[model samples]
Target chain A: MKAIALKLCSVTGMKWGIPFVKLFSGEEVLEQLKEIWGTVGIPLIAIVTFLLIWHFGAKQIDTSLGQVPGPAMVWEQTKALWAEHVDERIKADEFYARQDARNAAKLAKNPNANIRVVDYTGKPTYIDQIFTSLKTVFMGFLIASLIALPIGIICGLSKKIMQALNPMIQVFKPVSPLAWLPIVTMIVSAVYVTNDGWLEKSFIISAITVSLCSLWATLINTALGVSSVNEDYINVAKVLQLSPTKKTFKIVLPATLPLIFTGLRISLGVGWMVLIAAEMLAQNPGLGKFVWDEFQNGSSQSLARIMVAVFTVGIIGFILDRIMVELQKLVSFDKKTIA
Target chain B: MALLELHNVSKGFGEGKYRTEVLKNINLSMEEGEFLAIVGFTGSGKTTLIKMISGLLSPDEGEILFRGNPVTGTSHERGVVFQNYSLLPWFTVYENVALAVNERYPDWTKETKDIHTRKYIEMVNLTPALNKRPAELSGGMRQRVSVARALAMNPEMLLMDEPLSALDALTRGTLQQEIINIWTKDKRTALLITNDVDEGILMADRIIPLTTGPNATLGPEFRIDIERPRDKTELNDNEEYKKTRNDIIEYLMDMGAEVKTKKTTNYRLPELKPIMPGKTFRKRKEEDKLKYF
Candidate 1:
């Protein structure tokens, strides 16, 4: 690094000493020369800039109601928080044992008074929220795929079906999943035939609402993509007298893959986005609930911790998209990998 | 009985708002192992006629029979080689051939399928590039792959819709010879749609000059009785071959004259350009002149 700086200094001195001669000489020589700084310079500059902002810009947030802690403070708290977490784990065991002893003691007095009387945190654990959110998103995505793929294929195959469905699809597509949350919550509350508790049914309703809102883009685009396949190939399939099943699998599906993949990527992104918002509105036991609860509590590190969750979400979503893209490249037949 | 017969087959496009007859009372028949070339104007329904025989489409006004069976939809018995690139873009030369091979011979094991598909690939002299996709292949190589694909199907009848017309002369000549070689060995019922007179003479047993559409029909059937395994380069030197060549040229010339006389008096234009023979466009101008009859 010192050698590089010295070299640059010498070059600059040379450039200053004889402007015309040095300028032309160095310009002509180094113009075509590959420089290490030239290759890695931009990214290095960007990383430095990002670090500076992350270190300094976070301090400027004028949050009045809740104190948004600095990165260093958060790091310190995070470590202390982990120790507290261990302590909490032991406390939880103690609490459960205490409940058992209390129940045993109370059986002699009155059995009803021993009915699980204990202090409730009324706040979600980090691990439970993460697991809950993941399960809900996975279930909602699966449900959406099952319903959308067939309808998409049908609309793709037949023009009349597309024409008939287009109006309804268009109408429902733009309405936000958040908009559907309240209606779904109400409907389920009214007609959940299971004698189960009211609270249990809301999660199912929220998932269905998220699915209906986020899944349309994939289905509509997939159908449109399948329809956009070259007419000649369809005729070729016809010329082969290929069975309907064969035509769908061999001809239609392969032709529509690039488009279908585009839809899938977009749907997954939308589904994840909708899921967070839905959980917030419904007070569901998920990551969204954790963020909302922290916000309401007005903790100093609440915003910083939420920032961590947000960044983590963004990183995870990016990785998921990249995985889909990699899978697409692998399955695609048109591209040749000499291997 | 004719191996394939088209009886008073007439076809038209659109109706009521706009109706135009493309073929009128088209009558033709071909025996088994007899090579027939149907030549015509571009939109003269030559392809449509062959399609009916191959069962790509049905004639609305008449009956087309393949050995007395009514033609309907696509039948595997009649295999077709289309002019434009019809080889699946995604499949390799080997895979393209294997598609039909595996379908036709499903009882064969994977090893057997590989062997048989390879045999046809070698037959077309495309073995080195068998693993290459259609996009990777040259025009001639792709056409050879198409030929291999059609042959692999092992159909009773072969229909070619100007299969070699897209190629340059050198590539065209090579594929024509390969096709003739394949034809002589199998002697399947073959129908070729072409406007190249020399190509017709070289390959088909009978050349049926298709008068150009909007109402194109067979003008005449010229017999090509040159010996089996006809060498393309040598045929250009034979006496009988020359006679047949001149006869076709004369017919096409008269057809062009007829086309010239129908609308305008510009029948005697100065030698603006040297007329290229055996090209489909020059031949199509002949049928386009059938304005009156």
Candidate 2:
């Protein structure tokens, strides 16, 4: 049972829990305590030290708006943001209830009274913006993967294809999201003619920009991974006389999965970074836009709110990376490649 | 027609000043159900030769034939067990074997394939580790899995490239016996490559030596006329086994010496005397005299 729990901890990137589990099992108590201190206690102390530093440091800095908001002010802003979201949700519910009552009254007064229920069009809350950012980033990441993985595999398989595409890949890899945003915005505006389409134009622009900037890491890493599959494994495939497709899926892909997941982790991180920049630059409705708007608002509380968004973005990025690590661990056979 | 044939086959690598002829004029033939072993020193193009027969590699100058047809590419008809085990690390023992079985008998039902895979795994006595991945297995067990995978394909011919060399002595002996037992059951055409003369003589009906490289080729073939089920202990007493083993060893040693002589280069030596650290030679002699007194 302890072994299973330890394995679970490693697989889920919850390695901090391992020492606790081991401590509970009462084996090598001193060692477990040391491990617990290293994994959990040290990190806790470090966080406390950082917060104390930030709290003291804020008093020394004087910006044009005011002194930089400390941890306390950021916490207040976070709570304020959550409270505003809750208040907006309550208002929306009341609006819906009032409309439903009015519709029922209209129907009772006259059997065929023309009654229409309009959709709520309230400004998005901070939580709503966070979801929007997540959705946008995921969509962008999916698009990048869909484009990168097949091309990467083909490039890995055939030298001629790689040679043909290498120059373009090199040229485009270093191009920033900032550079792609305007081009993507123009193209999206010209191509996306429908105003009432399922997707919003701003959303599409941000997603496309993210895809453009994020695909390179996945492409390069996957190609490298595929090309570097062990020669012995390839020989085994040949001995079996597997079909081209079967050989690729069975031997090449499985062998290169660790590297591919590494590429994906990098790609998702790039996509998330690119997504925020794109959303901010494009004035799209997401956390990036929220941050930018708060900066422009320049109110005393706006700086603290923007700091809250910064922390949110950083934490979300960390969680995304951790998720990819877990997925990589689950798929990869080689344990040494986990980190 | 021979089960397999190689005619005037030569293979090399690189080009221009860096070119090397790794194998040259390698000619061999095997009839149906023949157990042939090619013994050679390390880096003598043994693996290169086996790969050619398995169709993973093509000879630069000559063609390889199987059953009177020109060999083109790898096929399930010739299954190879590589030197490094080469079991896919991601796959369990069962999956590693099942992969080949599935590819060979694609039309078979899933259940049938599973049974066939399990049978081969059990043949290698790996039923306990059926679900264990290659990374989890020991070197010997991994090689067993490799052997099982090759055998599960039901190939007409089996090619093994130093499959047991990575294993410990005890494991190597057990796997060697298991392999022989499997080979003798159907007597499928088998080719085993190794540097060990005893391994060749014990398992092969015919043993051939591969000379040291830079144009390594097959030397004279020795026929192992001993009866089947040749026990390792009894082989020590068998006159024929001793004669064949000595002859092969003598021939190999002579070739090794010849190569050493051909490649040897003399270098001038510097005259230097050994001295104890932190003391002159006279001081050391004085200390030795005092210690004796």
DockQ of each: 0.34, 0.74
Write down the DockQ of candidate 2: 0.74
For each candidate in turn, the TM-score is 0.74, 0.92
Interface RMSD per candidate: 2.0, 0.8
Looking at model 2, the pairs that clash are: none
Find the 10 residues in a row with the least total lDDT in model 2 chain B: B284-293
Q: Global CA lDDT of candidate 1, please?
A: 0.76
Off by over 4 Å in 1: A1-63, A66-135, A186-206, A336-339, B15-20, B40-45, B90-95, B105-119, B126-136, B253-293
lDDT of 2 by residue, B188-273 (tens): 99999997888898899999999999899999999999998989989989999989988888788788778877775554446666
Q: lDDT per residue, candidate 1, B1-293, as tens digits?
A: 98888889888888876988778888888899989887765677877777677776778798888888888778778888887758877778887788788777879999999998999999999999978988889998988888888888888898898888888989998889888888888898888998677788888899888776766667877899999778888987999998987777677667756875774675666766655775678668646544211
List the per-model TM-score of the A chain: 0.72, 0.95
Question: Tens digit of lDDT per residue, candidate 1, span A97-186?
Answer: 888887888886886773777774634456557767777776777778788888898999899999999999999999988789989888
Q: Model 1: which residue pairs collide?
A: B212-B287, B259-B289
